[model samples]
Target: MINNKKYLVSFMLLVASVFTSNGQDDMDKFVSNLLQKMTLEEKLGQINLSSGNTGAVLGGGGEGQLIAIKKGEIGATGGSSFESIKKIQDAAMESRLKIPVLIGLDVIHGYKTIFPIPLALSCSWDTDLIERSAQIAAKEASASGVCWTYSPMVDIARDPRWGRVSEGSGEDPWWGSQVAKAMVRGYQGGDLSKNNTIMACVKHFALYGASEAGRDYNTVDMSHLSMFNGYMEPYKAAFDEGAGSAMSSFNLVDGIPATGNKWLMTDVLRDRWGFDGFVVTDYTSINEMAYHGLGDLKTVSALALKAGIDMDMQGLGFIGTLKESLDDGLVSMEQIDQACRRVLEAKFKLGLFEDPYRYLDENRLKNEVLTDENLEAARELAARSMVLLKNENNILPLNKKGKIAVVGPLAEATGDLLGAWVMYRNRDIVPSIVEGIKSVGGDDVEVLSAIGANLTNEPNLRKSLSSPFAMFMGEKMVVDERSLEVLIDEAIAVSADADVIVAVLGESTAMSGEASSRADISIPESQRNLLKVLLKTGKPVVLVLLNGRPLTIEWESENVPAILEAWAPGTAGGNAIADVLFGGYNPSGKLTMTFPRSVGQIPIYYNHQNTGRPFDENNKFTSKYLDISNEPVYPFGYGLSYTSFEYSDVEINKSKLNGNDKLIAKVTLTNTGDRAGEEVVQLYISDPVASISRPVKELKNYKKIMLQPGEKKEIVFEITPDDLKFYNSELIYDWEPGEFSIQIGTNSQDVKTASFVWEK
Candidate 1:
């Protein structure tokens, strides 16, 4: 019987060596050998992405993967554990090539040591730190057997209403591009052949962030010039850094859906910018093209392939349909071969061909994943992302001796701080805010708490989808007025005895991310009313805003004495927030996205073009709003440091420069306040006269400096002709010979100015 089994295995090996594949020569030889051993069905199996429907992780995974892999029906799955991925690999070995199954996960932020969300990281303005954060994420994720991450989303969004804005580097293409490269390097590291990192997918490939109405997956429209100059830089940066893959955006670019836009995928992604990676559709994007009125599965699949989409993710378009489409002249063998080779090359680069079970190391998972060091790093990152929105009367840096009334939906809620996209978190271990505060405050600080309101009162949003989403449907975020009043009344009664009120208010996990955006970005009405009652108690009301997006909080900004803009600090968020509140650490965090005074200023940003009638305090008819100020309530790149820094006069190395010469701009920043603090000295350039319209101010460079109380430092920034370059109507990326105004200051609008000229 053993001899028969051996003979049968040999026969099976012979049968495997018949059909299909090629990239790098060594890689090509290895893939061709593997493909020849794979049956036609097995060759076709490498393009599908299935996820288990357990819904534990952020994006989720596919079930029945083992059965599918056995039948050579699926190539890869989007997410899985090391053990599960190993099982899939085992199943793949039963096929001819013994090809390994690729695994993908949403390893955004740190995998285990959950850092501040992407939005908060952008505020740090430190590229090296951002890269290190991604490296930490990869270390933990790889320990869990994840080979790919859907991350480094480089969308340039001007709208704060868009919730996913938190997941990207902020609005400037130059800064965004810099951050994008850092993150890609962080994710991929020096080598994917090693076990410490995974492939990075530069995402929303074309222009998903420019969603119409700032709604998730909404239609997008922009001029070609806008695409080239404003949004595409970060993606190109990622590609230039050798990103392994690209995930097409859910929305269209110009008139075409990104996945099906030949001009975007072929011309721009492949031809113009020269990105050589395979393109994968976002979850079910090709199937959902019907919503975009693109066509049925067959037509859309054909269109996507022809447009250069290499893989279909969760769309079911590339399975059997892709092969038939190939035979019908809809798509050619070359296209299929090209895509297959790309996928195969990725697997090869992952070192899976050398050892398919490389990621299944049990010891690594036990020791390297979620270690205490990572948690400490996460705590530090969280603390850094928290911005002090207000601190009237020195109410913040809370006294540990004071009686504290901590009340809100999120104050004591341990469950939510983990947040969405936290598939890999050790759910129970992350300290809740209440737990964190208690950890340090102890019995010395009397702590009182109340859930004054639920996250939202709405009962039915996408009733069939998720219940948490129902609450954010309207103005009444938490609907139980009497219940809210009872809790608020209790909190008020407690505050009457306490010295201060630490009122934590913000959205639930469901209120921000994909399918989570608000037209009215504000503190939920239930919480707002609760705050009003709390304020009436005459206690020091400190607002701790835990939101996923920048909210419009004009009234709160004016009335509240102290406010903390904590953008959903992940995992150990509660403890991190507690650290900043009680003077354990000073708050140095700043805003990456703009905080609007109202929703009317939906697209408010620091880098807006100088309208023909630009808003001026002196001009009544010049681009002024009828009632509201044209200025944003809170500007982008705007965040307060613990201590104040005074800006000195702007100094330039030279008033004029000839062609191809460089300029040095200098500013003296003095720590004119009592406490040691961090300050982001911003440098913006303005083109007073240009062939085309230009922004009133463009953030060119900035330095985040830490100083002693009386310390003063001179910051010098180098400027080449490259710094002044812009994409003109003719699409040339170069600087125009002209006069440039330099403004140096604390923030965008508040600044000291000087002038320089690049001579013709």
Candidate 2:
């Protein structure tokens, strides 16, 4: 019977392989035939990605874009409304080739039905939930006539000062890789031909997260070993999972702009990683190469094509100069043909050739987009994304029937909660924090609300920092005319009669996104003062942060009775926050990024190579901070739940193992508290001795499990030589036989350690 089952499985695998091979063969023949019919100008046109709208990223769009579509001078367009997309598709049908124009959008976290920001979502440590969120995003985006998404931005970010960190999974490469694979699976699904599934574009191809000084579009310098071992895993993982496309970043890699980096785009992504997807430049990045001192527009366009960039995004570089370059012998006809073939192949795989309007169905738009089910999922995801940073003396799970004072600038905010990268949403339907409290608490709860402070004291700074999106949406930065003292006095008076205070404060919608980096990542001074005064009223205060990146909240940690990192919890953010506060749900989200105690610790992270002189409290000459402790305010993977959990010492099956042998590590976890909750069991592996210096520990694997009150479960993890491998100084990835420490715990800093030995 066992032999028969094995034979049956083998047969099924063979059948599936043959089916995939046949599909590829068909796609190649179709794309090749279409390429032969194209003129040199037409070939250049196929690789040109124009913008249909002006929001999100900077690009050119207007009536000219429609004319280009009709003339077959544009292949793809992004940032367009459903109505606009229909018109664009109509123009494409009128062209000579009748090729469908691929509609793309930056569907980062969610579409119309917004979920928590990516950083917040990573805190959940639930890949299934993350993938589900992506699936919903794809469904909504595809329903709105978008066939592609520039998402799953898998750049591994350790520096919170980089505002784009909000778009990626947190620090650890392994964790980011898992999230990357899940996102691809969710967006692309098993088949891109499905109407609800859109092609996923893994973005910022090279290292954009390791920007110098955590500044946007800054130069990135790193050794090849560092790239392979530290930051390149997530991008490779997304591509391995069959993401259909990639986007070059705005930054420079190895002193060259990523848009024209041959080593990064071709050698690593294609030659080493075997990524078959077409590469697109980030918003006019090809033209910006001239500013990078590369050459003139035509020279840079030729260089970009030679670097294996398949599509020019809104630069007009390929369309405007590729023909001239081809004639000058700077670029070859074969190169242009290859680039154009990739784009057409992508569309062919999406089944656009058979039905260009497959994703433009009006019925799907009406029935699928922002449905009740999607909102409910968003609410649940938002609740799970919240990390309970502090719950001193168990101040959370506040009684539902109390005089709850909800005060802060974000208390009644609707748009700010959606965070960045949200181009399309119905802001009118978003519920405010106070409204959620009232609705969830029912008639028994009396909710007193007040905007205790403005988002910032400097109105001019706020106006200057206002995103261009505000102008597009016909919105203005509305500043409160009331004095800070007056607002604080009113807040104090309102909270005097309340039993507890839920202070919703943090960054506005304009903060912590692309080009929105901050020197100070903390609560604004006005809001901090209000929080300080609220504490003086003898009321237990819950600091609910609604920001994108991890914030420095040392003062709040020491003073506030409770704290929650809400992270701009999307459209249903308010409802989710209310549910967690009222004990309807227990927070299981953990911090993916480290929260430093001060701005001085600019690049703090959990996984770092220990110096020769490691920090020792007993030694004065050690590498230690003179003013503040070296420890972060909140370490990575740290989150508090309503219930408590106790972990037993790690038990190893073998102290010594030979080549290809698997070692088993087990930990018995018990829910010690009297409430049901979930815990993320993190596994870390450390190489005490390696060919080169290694991080103190690296997150290898983790599992999220739920337990009833007082229940116990034995969690097991399997380790092999593969789990202990790292890139040496020579850029060779392999394991060195040595002592390895196995860590099992809730967070990176707090763990139970055991040792094992492995040999080749």
Candidate 3:
């Protein structure tokens, strides 16, 4: 048995070595051969990424652009449709070198058949499902003629005030890295040459999520140790999983714009991490460097190229000013060639060089996109993405036998269901909350809905919310202009005739993505008024929140008997919510981000460092808030299932460990409630003493499992010294020989623990 195990290990090692050696050799050979034959003009064109109108909120390119493509003046485009991409590729075929154009898009969550937003999807704690969503997105997108997707934004976001928090996996670097790897594998598949797969691009290169005050495109300043410890894990994870491309962020990394930051782009990414993928700038980011006080377009463009940016997305800086910069001795020919080679290498790896029309199948487009099978998957995923925040007295798993009154501006909202970065027409096809309730509840349950209030009561505020970028934000919710009292009265009237009320309330889709940060992360005043009136009617109220970021819902949590965070669940959102509400599906999703009681706890997260003086209600000198406690409304990994789970004390296989040693931590979990359900078993490690102060507890591993009522299951996790390593004060990545705590829990705060020692 020992000999057989050794043989199996040897075989796997040999296979991995061969895969790496051959893949790199083939890619380098193809790119080199292509580069040798290319002219200066063609080389520059390969580093140019312009945009085309796919009816989304980016640039538009037409026949004039097609002529440029034929001249080998364009390399890639975003937001272009299949028909348009075919035209662009056809134009490229007429070029001297016939290099195919790569079609890309911000296929964030889902392509046509939209799923839950990224933030909500992470709540499932199901990497397999997240990967499946990415795989389906790739299939749908590739069918539509796109070969690349700008997604899996794995930024570790702690501040909910950042609107783009909706686009990421939440605040824990360890968990976020896992999600990142899953997304990359899902998009690129095992082989990039597959006709159904698309290339994955890890985005916003550095700490764009930690923008000051949670504002988009703001300055980011953090220590090197902090960067390595916290923000850099997801990008590294994606690269390790073989993502083909990266996008430079809009923010400055230590005072220099990321587009022109050499230490970041070259030293950290290329040299240290050994990333061979091409780097592209976010929309006009290279050009925006001028506004960042870097220099003129030409100077900043030259800096970006020198800093290792391979392509300029929506910024014609490379094509327009690179040659001039070259002649001026501001950039070298070798640097230009290197950038161009990387871009061409991506095309080669995508199999576009061999067959330009590989992804342009009309039959696949017809059969694959928005199919019933895909929508069903979307519905199932959306159902899993929902986190049940509060279920007082078992108020949820609601019976479908009663009349359900759905009230709020978002209750009947169709467009908002398909969150940001989606086609405008998707809203027309999605089922509204009321429609979903009706569909799932069937003939027995009567579902009635009313737009209880406008998204906001103030007229001027509604106007301010309007966005010129219509495709990205969608048209602002139209105000009723009727008196607030009248809207509340109608809501009350609807609830009076129903056995139960579902108050669908929260931000509109536009209010929680990109540049849409909110200072007050709560139910809007108008919706709060509507909810209060509904509560007064003596009906059992269920607060169904359809939002992007984590909201401060203290009032709702206290007053409402049940609260469900639906989180802009996509095309089949209504149906998914219906399934959960009507007891067809049990809620298993956990909170990836912390839910604060108030916005004052802006940057609160579970893996926070301990203060010199820890919080103490008894001591006035400690880090305690006089007005409120330091606890969050709902801690990270917190969620409620229809059935409850009980955890046993953590048992460790070893009390001491040395080099290459494995420690097994085990715990017994039992479903103590009446029904069968799923739970996320989380394992966290704590370094009580280290060179630098570490977080109170860092999540190391997690598992999602199902159990029948009264059934017990044993959960085991293998731990190693490598898991104890962190970036220290000197920025050294290594573990210290010390005592550590192994915590096993359903959530971060509630845990059972055991201790062990490690010697170097």
Candidate 4:
């Protein structure tokens, strides 16, 4: 009977493989036929991506964009409204070939129904939830007539100083790789041809996250071994999961702009990793190559074409100069056709040839965008994204009956809750923290609210930052001309009668994202002054932080009774915060990035390589800091729950692991506290000896499990030689024979460890 079942399963698998092969064959035939009949100018048009004059307009020559579309001089356009996108598609239909333009947008965290920022979402440690969030975003975006998303920015970021870190997964390459796969699956779904699914673009192709000094668009110089071992995993994972497109980073790889780096875009992405996706340059990246001293516009355009970049996004380099380069023999007709074919192939896979209006259902747009179901999902995700940084004496789960004063500038503001790279049109739907407290308190708790200070006291800085995104629908940072004493007096008056205070503070919407890096990532002085006074009110304070990146909150950690890393919780952020505060949900989110005690520890992270002289707190001659301790204020994967858990020391099945042999490591976990809650059981492996220096600890696997109060469960993880593998000095991916430590615990720093030996 077992043999018959196996035979039947094998038969089914064979049939599925044949089906997939037939589909690929069909796609190849269609793309081949389409490429043959295309003119040189028309083919150049296929590789040109222009931004429509509507949302976040960046490039010039917008006046002729419509005419360009009608003449088949444009293939794709991004950052435009649905109405405008349809007009471009209509113009494209007027061309001789009637090719539909692929619509792209920065649907990063969400579309209309925004969720927590990507950094916050990573803290959930739940790939399923992350995938669901992406699926919802794709549904909303597709309904709104967008066929592609420049999202799943899977760049692995370790430094909090990098503003774009908010858009990626956390520090560890393994964790980032998981997020990359989940996001790709979510955006594309089971099939790309479906109306609700949009093509996923894995971005910043070659290490934008590792920018020098954590500055965006800075140069990155690293060994090939370092690249393969640490930084390149997420992009490769995204490609493995079938991401349809890739975006070149703004930084240089090996001293050459990635937009013109042939070895990176072609050799690594295509030849090495087998990524069959089309590549697009970041906004005018091709044009910026001139500034990089690579060449003139035409020279850079030709270089970019040969670098395996299929489309020039907003650069106009391909459209403006590729023809001239082609005549000059700098670019060949075959190269242009190859680039054009890839773009057309992507459009063909999206089923745009059959139905250009697949994602243009007016009914879906009305019924689907920001629906209650989507909003509820966002709320649930936001709640899960919240990391309980500190909960001294269980100050949270505040009794719903008390007088709760919601203070701080962010308390009543809805616009700033949605982080950077968000759908700008969804500001009105966001509920303020005050509204959330009231809605959830429901007459049980008297929720007093006050804006204690402006988001920033610097009026000129706020205005300068606000002007860029003023075109989008949302509230900007409003500088109060009133005296600081007046704002504080008003806040103190409101909180004077309150039993407890919930202080909502942190970066405004303009703070940590894409060109908004800060040397000191801390609570602003204006808000800190308010917080210092609030503590004097003799009330238990809960610091609810809303920022894009991990902040240095050493003072708050030591003084505040409770603190929550809310991140920019998005449209449903307020209600989510209320739910967690009132014990409706227990926070299971963990920090994906390390929180340092001071700005001096700028590039701190969990999986860092130990120096020749490791930090010794007692030894001044060691690698310890002069003022602050070497440890992070809060380590990666650290979080608190309403309940407490105790873990037993790791038990290994065997002390030795051989090639292809799986070793079992078990840990007995018990819910020792009063309330039932969930915990993320993380697994880390330490390679004390390797071909080259390795990180002290590296995350290999993790599982999020729920347990009833006083209940005990045994968790087991399978370890193999593959998990211990890393790129050696020679850039070879292999594992060396060594003694390794296996750790099982709640976070990276605190773990129960056991040693084992791996033999070749």
The TM-scores, one per candidate, come to: 0.93, 0.95, 0.95, 0.95
RMSD of each: 4.2, 6.4, 6.8, 6.5
Clash pairs, model 4 backbone: none
lDDT (Cα, tens digit) per residue for candidate 2, span 1-760: 0022433343344233323332888777767767776888778778988752222232223566777777888899874667777777777767777777888988988999998889888988988989999999999888878889999898888788888999999898999999999999999999899889999998898889998888888888888877888999999889989999999998888889999999989998899889897999998999999988999999999999999999999888999888888888999999999899999889988977766777877778788889999999999999999999999989899887869999998899888888888877567989988998999998989999889888777655476456575434322355778888889888988898999999999887677778777777888888898899999998989989988898889989999989988888999998999999888999999999999999898788898889999899999999989999999999998999999999999999999999999999999999999999999999999998888889999999998989999999999999988899888888777899989999999999899999988989
* Residue runs of model 1 more than 4 Å from their true location after superposition: 1-24, 32-40, 51-63, 458-482, 617-620
Once fitted onto the true fold, the runs of candidate 4 whose alpha carbons sit more than 4 angstroms away are: 1-22, 51-63, 470-475
Sequence-dependent TM-score of model 3: 0.95
Please give the ranking of all candidate structures by lDDT, highest first, separated by commas: 3, 2, 4, 1
lDDT, each prediction: 0.77, 0.86, 0.87, 0.86
In model 3, what is the error at residue 241, expressed in angstroms?
0.4
lDDT of 3 by residue, 437-486 (tens): 99899888988778888898665557656646534574466677788778
Model 3, runs deviating above 4 Å: 1-26, 51-61
Query: How many clashes does each candidate structure show, in the order listed?
Result: 9, 0, 0, 0
Candidate 3 whole-model C-alpha lDDT, 0 to 1: 0.87
lDDT of 1 at 673: 80
